[model samples]
Target: MDSSVSSLTQYGSFRKPTFPLSNSCRHKPRRWPLALRFIKGAIHHVILVPILLHTLFTCIIVYIHINIQTLSVPANIVPSLSIVVGLMLVFRNSSSYDRYWGGRTNLQSIGTSVRNLTRSFLVCGPDRDEADRKETEKVVKVLVGMLYAVKNHLRSTWGHGYLLPEYKGLLPEGMYGFESEGVGLVLELAVVVERYIKRGVDRGAFNAPQSSMLSSQLNALVDAYGKMETIKLTPIPIAHQIHQKQVLALYCCVLPFCLVDELGWLCVPIICLICFMLYGIEGIGEEIEDPFGSDKNDIKIDAIIEDLRQEVSVLLDSWRRGGEEYTI
Candidate 1:
């Protein structure tokens, strides 16, 4: 009995009813029939400062036209720069979306590996004797620990208050002091799992092929762990980010000047609309660049973790009740 294994048993006893889980932002549906869905978490919050500045600048330009005679930048200037700005925004958004989708896929892979490994441990693993049952339970606990560790690892939330209360004491004392504690915990649990597989193989409970298959599943889990680390640690290029922002600022600032003479006071609302469109798209890309964050558009890591917990609980329960044999 590993302490981690012991903690898992205690944790498992308090299972709650599982609700539907969503990977997207969990917004309550609006009661108003005419409410716009597109503006749910629009760029408004992020671009407030820029929007205010743009508004003030537009008012000044309008005042100049009315009081000090017509003063306007050539509207032709816009068409010249619009193409470059459009392409950069397109590329920036696409690149960030790729990262977001990649993180989602990685999380899905981790979930799949967890479910597969847990089912294999409970069903394919030996459970005839008390020792076999205990050992299998230990392996199951390690699987649970792996899931939590991976979640914490990607979020960079480690130590005392970060983990679920039940998993608090699961990690060894040594892990608590490590710099990359969450990652170290996952690696340590993976090692423990391998050791248990070997033990099962030596006990004549699992054949070489059975152990190999289980080991491969564990390897898949480890691979996912590494993939997540890659996504979290590797960010979009700094130069690209800086350049995009600069271009967006320049475009927004110059827009009002271009349109003022043509639209007069109407330029303020028009410019505001354009700012919303451009800045909103840019904000969305930035929000999802690292989908592990708490932003509305960020991947729902907490919900995903809960789904894994519930799935594992159900599988464990089925095993305890002595259900029909589970196949691969």
Candidate 2:
């Protein structure tokens, strides 16, 4: 028991530290009270029309079965049909969650690459003269601008007018015409950064090997951009989504007939409860599948970008201090 305790203590020490940039951590899934949750939850909003309609249908079925006709379905059919519907929901929810998690992973990769490249640019590159210092500062600003441009591009918010004021001036004069050229603004900014790097090489600020390393970091940034684009653009097939909804609707519709015989009027509320659960599951999949939208459940990219901005500011400060002489 002592050995086990010691191992657990060691494991606890190595656990990952939480940061505000992670939307899942910063904006934890809320647990409103049952009444409030019905009003506030995204799932409820989506399934409200269906639930109301189904509840009405359930009442009608129940009334007809008791007053006019003896309506019922074999109890065994419920279990058998449920198995198939459950599998379909599981598959859909699983696939959507995978896309969500993959998007988060790519976001972290982008942050990591930005930090590394900025550090290398500031520390390893030359800053021997005022001109050299200004060049380094320009490149650093462009690096950050590229990050913001990527975020805007993913959101489909184009135009240089959308960029922050400080970063706006740093962009090339003709950059406003990026859309006309059929090139992504983020890619165009990358091209600008590369040109600055090439100029640095020509001026002997970076040795060939150092330049190569920096270029690899730039590649990582673009690779992450490509991956996130794939996530944003390539949604789960519409045909599969339509099919799943059809099956779920069928399940909810048939569930009442199966229960009305055994439970009678009590099955009305029971049907609502079951519809809420099943439709809620499918609704959650829709909410999280994209992970990049402005929805509360989507990634908090604005927060993440703000955090990155803070980090870049600190790095800039460090670069300035290192250039100054200190008295002991």
Best by TM-score: 2
Model 1, position 262: C-alpha lDDT score: 84
lDDT (C-alpha) at residue 173 in model 2: 51
What are the per-model numbers of colliding residue pairs? 0, 0
lDDT of 1 by residue, 90-198 (tens): 9989988998898888888888888888877887687768888877776776677677777777777675324456465344333443535324668878888888889
What TM-score fits each model? 0.84, 0.85
lDDT of 2 by residue, 137-240 (tens): 77787777777777777888766754556356456554574665678877877887788678778888888998898788888889998999999999989999
lDDT for each of the candidates? Answer: 0.76, 0.79
The superposed Cα distance between candidate 1 and the true structure at residue 217, in angstroms, equals 1.3
